[model samples]
Target: MEPAEMTSLRAALAESDFAKPPRINLRGEPIPDGLTTAVVYQGHEVVTDGSKPLRGLDRVIGGS
Candidate 1:
């Protein structure tokens, strides 16, 4: 994800009541999951300026 997207997400997570680091699965792999509604930017669909983006490695380019 881009830095700007991340910055916005951080702000929203900070305001949330249940924001927390994700836990790992039994195989020692971190489960990918997030909570938050998101709004897609008009010019860039991949770009979201939503209150919550539920960001993770899965959302980042090359992170896959």
Candidate 2:
């Protein structure tokens, strides 16, 4: 992720009710499971292990 985008995401996460800091899973690292995950890549194809992006991220605010 770009620095500015990462910063914004961090700030937004901090102000939210996420129980833990978001994990940054990089290539060669084992991907986490059973949690909300966002796989960001520069391409039109998405190859998650069956994970999906959270629709309406606003709904996650305040731990809802």
Identify the candidate with maximal lDDT: 2
Across 1-64, the per-residue lDDT of candidate 2 in tens digits comes to 7898677666655454343323332344455663333533332222232233323333332234
lDDT of 1 by residue, 28-54 (tens): 333357233332332222322223233
**Which pairs of residues collide in model 2?**
none
> Which stretches of model 2 miss by more than 4 angstroms?
20-64
Which ranges of candidate 1 are over 4 A from the true structure?
A: 19-64
TM-scores, each model vs. reference: 0.28, 0.32
Candidate 1: deviation at residue 18, Å?
2.1
Task: Give the Å shift of residue 3 in candidate 2.
Answer: 0.1
Query: Backbone clash tally for model 2?
Result: 0
Model 2 lDDT, residue 64, Cα: 41
Weakest 10 consecutive residues of candidate 1 by summed lDDT? 17-26
